[model samples]
Target: MTFKNTLEFAQKLDAEDKLARYREEFIFPQHNGENVIYFTGNSLGLQPKSAKRYVDEIMTDWANLAVEGHFYAEKPWWDYHDRFAQKLAKVVGAKPAEVTVMNTLTVNLHLLMASFYRPKGKRYKIICEEKAFPSDQYMISSQVRFHGYKPEDAIVEIKKREGEHNLRTEDILNKIEKVGSECALVLIGGVNYYTGQVLAMEEITKAGHKVGAFVGWDLAHAAGNIALKLHDWQVDFAAWCSYKYMNSGPGNASGCFINEKYHNLKDIPRFEGWWGHKKDERFLMKPEFKPEAGANAWQISNPPVLAMAPYLASLELFAEVGMPALIEKRNTIVAYLEFILQEIDKEVPGTFEIITPSRQEERGTQLSVFLHGQGKALFDYLMNHGVITDWREPNVIRLAPAPFYCSFEDMYNFGQILKKGIQDKS
Candidate 1:
């Protein structure tokens, strides 16, 4: 498709967008009087318009039912988390039985590691990507320590080739093979939080399994951004937070995937609780621990219905507009954003460098731009000018043209703001 940098071209794309009608569904942040051109959905998604109604319903139910709300509420608190499983299973590409909504992201990560990260004898090393989100690093270090091993010895990070921003698929696969029998688990993010690089999850899963390592993904950035096939690809387990791409509000409950094979694996030691007890026997307060089948077996406590409400609202929108539509819109928006970026780069050489991959399949809608000789000043300029994007560490700006709520006009305006910022800085 031919590209142009004119406002008319941008407007034309917006006019033709099939998903344009969904833009009003989100409540964007305001700057001065106008809504900011939000490009931080990769960090925190905008609130869905129906979020209040969802939460209000729960509040009303609680007021009326009191303690009986567990079985009597609009959405029964007893089975509240179960409501998202079928929908979420579709999102992460898993069977309904294999997926469940549980605690927050890191909590689910720790829970999954507890069940899957059983370091035995010499086969105790774990592999992850370098520069993974800090929480993951801390979690891995703590887990290894709990298992009586030093992090430096038990954790093997797959690093990028010298000076490269993203780790190559072959490099990660080779690392798995090199670790071989000593590799007990391969846990990595589906998308690198900083670089916006989408890893080859299927290949990675296969490589780990080939070497007798349990494979899993931290899909915080990938869950709602890209199409995944966790079940089809035979991924052992995966977890993701909904606050970002899923627009489930800040620090919402997370979704988890456990391959059906583990549902019956009685040998695996798990951190169990009453919520995970067999549903029929849970109300009876049974002394014996009998876990429910599938991923629901991992639940620690009854889900917080009020907190899960916003997720239901966001997920309902996702169900209305399927992932295929979202993916199509994302591809075009990203292409336009990339086009504008290339033009800006040509106009002001060395001002910034795009670290995200150019290939559509290799990334989501996010593009992480590394400032050359500049710092947060340019980011501040964009923010002050009504462009709400995320900034990372020493010098990187992360912009995401979220498909569900963000518009083509927003991307166009973002490019315009970026161009002006460059011209002013130069």
Candidate 2:
């Protein structure tokens, strides 16, 4: 489909959009008198209007039921985390028993590593992407250090080909093969935070398994933005935060997936707490830790209910629209966004370049643009003019037109703003 940079063309596309009405479901921030063009969903999603109601319900339940709220509240605080299993499993493409909600993203990754990152003797190295999110880099390094190995020796980073903006699939697989017998684990961001590149997770997971490595994904940017089949991919484990595309509040609870094959493995070590004990036996205060039968076994404590309330609210939206519909709109809006960027780039020749992969499957809702002749001045201009985007260090601007709330008109308007910002600088 041809994309034209015009208000009428964009409005026409919006008018025909089946998901456009759902945009009203979100609450956007005002820039002057109009809603800002929100392109930072890869960092933080717009809040759902229903989030307040969800949080209020928990507040009301606590006020009325007091100590008995655990058993008597409408959602039953004792089993609040259980409510996420089915809804979240559908979102990430896993079985209900294979998924659970628990700590924040990094915390969950650390806990999961306690079980998946067993580095015995010769098989100690972990393969990850170069320039991974700082938190992941810290986590992997600390884990390696705890196991008595220097990060330089244990972490094998798959570097991008000299001048490339993204890691090639062949380079990643070759790195795994090179690590070979030394590769104990393979963990990569399912969607790269920097370049917005969606890695070939299934093929990478296969290759990792072939090399006797436990493969996992940090789905912080992938979970709600892409179509993931963690179970079918045979991913050993995975974790994702709910705040970004999931539209949960900032720093909210995380969703986790542990393959069913590992559910009953008693020998696998985990950092256990009462919440991970057998449900029926939890209140009994058993002397020994009897692990919950599925991913919940990784829970370190009872869930933070307030933190999870918004997540449940967002999952309801996911259930209503489903991922298939989201992906359909995502493909169109993102392509349209790319088109807008190209149109604008032509106007301001050689000023910017989209570092993100051109293929639909190789990218998500985000497009990371490499500003060539522009800098923070251009970013500041866009932000000051009602365009909310994410700016990385040096000169990259990450624009994520989240399909759920971002409209075609936003793409057109952003293009206009971008072109003007460049021309003004000149």
Candidate 3:
């Protein structure tokens, strides 16, 4: 789909979009009463209008039933967390029992680490990307420290070759092989938050397993933005926050996945809480901690129904428009964005370059632009002009044109703004 100009291209793409109707479902943020071309879905997705209704339903139950809402309401607040599991499982390609909605992203990462990051005498190191999200880095470092290991000795950080923006799979595989005997776990983001580089999960999992190390993923940016097959990939454990791409509200309840193979593993120690106890035997209040068979066994506390509401709303939207179809649409828009961005780069030489992979399958919806010298200024100019996107430190601006609501027009408009912003700054 070539465009004569940005506007015409946007209008044409919007006309052909199968998911175009979904745009009406969200509340687009406005600046000075004008709708902003929201490309920041990679940071915090716009709220679905149905989110209000979902919250209201719970609110109504809370109002009328009060204390009884837990046991007597229509959906029964006591089991409300289970209501979201089926749809969430579909989104991430896991069996219903293998997935559960629970605590926030960082918290869940720690909980999963407790169960999966067991480091025996010789196998005590963990491998992760060099620029993982700050919270993830903190969690891994602290976990290593808690287990009586120095982070320098226990954490192995992988970086790309000099001048390269993305890590190569071969390099990662080699690193895993080199340290396989000493490595206990491999934790990585499905799509890097800063570079938008999608790692080869299947190959990574295979490499880790061959070396007898556990594999887990931090899917905060990948969930809903990309298609995931956790079970098929043999991902031992995974965790994600629902705010980005999922269109769930800010700080929404997070989710986790555990392979069914671990369902019967008795030696894997987990930090136990009452909510994770088997449901039927929960009321018995038995002293022994007999965990529920699958991912629910990892839960520590009762779920926050309010936090889960927005996620349920988002998952219903995902189910309505399946992931494969969404991925196809996303690939088209992302390619178009890349094309235009490259055009801009050509016009203003040496100003900016896309750091995300060029291959369609190697990325999700995001394009991380590396600004050569004036990144912060250019980012500020775009933001002030109402072209909203995210800026990472040192020098990269990330834009994700989410398929659920973003139009080709939004991308074209963003290109126009970006070109103008770059030229003006140059």
Candidate 4:
């Protein structure tokens, strides 16, 4: 699609969009009873209208069946976690057996790390991007320390070149080559939280594996925002929270993916619980922990049906639109946003810079805008005026036009608001 300069062009794009009707499926927030142009899906996605009904189903099951709801409920809460796996797998490009809906993001990360980050004698270091989400940094540091290794010695942080905001794929490959022998695991965010830089997962995974390192990704920002091929990319494991692009409510149930290649590996130690036991003999109360094959083996406890309700509801929507089609639409909308933001920058030179990569393949739905002067104040003003966006520390304001609900008009309106906000301040 060519660059469009006016709101009419955006509206025409929206008018022609096949996924256009999906927007009304969500419940947009109101400021003074008016629906504001919401661009914060990078932080918290809008609630699905069907979510209430989904939660109510669980509530009804609990009211009637109580403990027996596990086996007898309408949806059979006993295997409820498995219900959404196949569809969720489609979104992340993993085999159905390789994906499991389970605990929250950070907890799942710790669990996957336990299995993958086995630091033996000479191979003890872990590699990750430097500006990773703080939770990931803390998890890696704590895990390294727990293994009686100094974080400084055991953690290798790959950073972008000075004066640049995104990591280069070549630099990442070089680092992996240089440290592959000592690296126990290569863990990275599939898409960076701050810069919105989508890493070259296929190349990174191959490089990491060439060094005999386990490759894992934190897909918190990438799962629903971009098309992932975890199995094809040969990523050993991955985990993601559903609250963002997945549009589940805050603190929603999270998911993890384990490649089928590990399904038969009996020696990979896991933190086991009864819920992970094979279904046929799960009720036998057997002393031996015979884990279910694939990612389900990582389950530590029975999932909260209430917590998973929203995710199931959201997945149904994803199933309807299909990820490939949604991604095609997302590429167009994101490009539209970038084009408009660039035009705004041209008019007000030196006032703002887009830190996200301009290339479509290097990003998802987000654009990280770096305000030059009065960053926080400008962000505050935008927010006060009902332009909802998320502000990161230092100077970045992140805006995501989620493909499911965000319209092209939203991007056009945001550009206008941003220009006016900056000009008024100037």
* Tens digit of per-residue lDDT, candidate 1, span 64-182: 98888889887888898888978888888899999999889999999999988999999999999998999999999999999999999999999999988888999999999999999
What stretches of model 2 exceed 4 Å from their correct place? none
Per-residue lDDT of 299 in model 4: 93
Residue-level lDDT tens digits of model 4 in 270-304: 78998899988989999998988778988989888
In terms of lDDT, the best-performing candidate is: 2
RMSD of each: 0.9, 0.7, 1.3, 1.1
TM-scores for all predictions: 0.99, 0.99, 0.97, 0.98
- Give the per-residue lDDT digits (tens) of candidate 2, residues 210-288: 9999999999999999999999999999999999999998888888999999999979988999999999999999899
- Stretches of model 3 off by over 4 angstroms after superposition: none
Ranking by lDDT: 2, 1, 4, 3
**What's the CA error at residue 294 for candidate 2, in Å?**
0.9
Name the TM-score of candidate 1. 0.99
| lDDT of candidates 1 onward, in order | 0.91, 0.94, 0.90, 0.91
How much is 109 displaced in model 2, in angstroms? 0.5
Q: After superposition, how far is residue 136 of candidate 1 from its true place, in Å?
A: 0.3
Residue 227 CA displacement from its true place in model 1, Å:
0.6
